[model samples]
Target: MTQAVAADLPIWAALPVALLLLLGAGLALTGTLGLLRLGSFYERVHAPTLGTTLGIGCVLIASMLYFSVLQTRPVLHEVLIAVFMTVTTPVTLMLLARAALYRDRREGNDQVPPPPPPPRGGQEEGPDGTTEEMAAMDRAELAERR
Candidate 1:
């Protein structure tokens, strides 16, 4: 079947498609700026994730709409692409976060919290029913000993 060109589309369908494409491009650009401008890895990871997901969604929806109209049938390949991105992006973010945290802690970076102490058997819990006080006390004793 011959494909319908953009110029041949009725105004009703063309306007939304054009708007969506522009919006998608804008969102993607914003994300790119965020990635470049953010200072920290933690802060930086979020921008692209949100930006790309929403941006791509807009672009894909536009493509789906334009093609569906052109072919006079519901074009759905974009759905698969959207689902794949939605599934992968968050998983990638988490993995990168964990890896960065691990590397930072290994290098003794002070920004991240220290690893929790090993569990002790039969240790009396503090009034708050937590080992927080005990850990603090132990840390204090170690400091004094040194």
Candidate 2:
């Protein structure tokens, strides 16, 4: 943001603009820190979204407010850019993450789903897809009929 644009802003507006800018910077910094410090792969995937969403949003909104008051016009281009970014960032992030997962799976990395647990004593499945308990009951009824 240009200092010239905000030179004429009143203290009330200036305070908010400065505060918002600082907040935006702080969010972005936190996002970067999270990406570096977090241990899990999935946790890292979502770290930058904080910056992409609220950090950039706050900065853009502050710019919009500043320029609108300074230029005495609507200062709408920033708003449009902000809207576009807010909507697209998450979608693109998701698509990228999904693509990475697909690639990893296709390449047969160590990301396979865990094996199904062995059936327990009373819950063993029969070959025909019935449980052992049910098959045993069926056999008892057949003997009675005979």
Candidate 3:
């Protein structure tokens, strides 16, 4: 490393990078732990976003600061990286969960709720109609159809 670059990074500048790196690591670890400990698929899928959003954010900001100081110019690559990560993480999680659900459903697993039963032909009634009235109306409609 050049002496000029080394001189630019004083203790004050390095402090933010150190704090960010540590914070980012801790958040990532917490997210991983949550992923492991969470019981359900939805919770597990959501846990990693902690790492993707805030964790990566801290680390990226630190990188941007360090590189900018070293290069004597604004380093914006990390900003792009952070933005790309934020946009992609949730979408990726959703796709993966959807694929998993599809596979489970294809195998006839009962992991997800089944489709609702088809509607029966009956006289349209408002919310005031009772269950017995609906059943009678449906029966009359069925008899008429027959």
TM-scores for all candidates: the values are: 0.75, 0.68, 0.68
Global lDDT of each model? 0.86, 0.81, 0.83
Clashing pairs in 2: none
Residue-level lDDT of model 2, residues 1-146, one tens digit each, is: 65554267888889999999999999999999999999866678889889888999999989988988888888888878888997888898889877777777778778645333444455455577656667776665566558
- Report how far off residue 48 is in candidate 2 (Å): 0.6
Ranking by lDDT: 1, 3, 2
Error of 3 at 74 (Å): 0.9
Kindly report which residue pairs in candidate 3 clash with one another: none
Please give the range of 10 consecutive residues that has the lowest summed lDDT in model 1. 116-125
* lDDT for position 146 in model 2: 82
TM-score of 3: 0.68
**Tens digits of per-residue lDDT for model 1 on 13-78?**
999999999999999999989999999888898889756699999999999999999999999999
Off by over 4 Å in 1: 1-7, 119-146
Clashes per prediction?
0, 0, 0
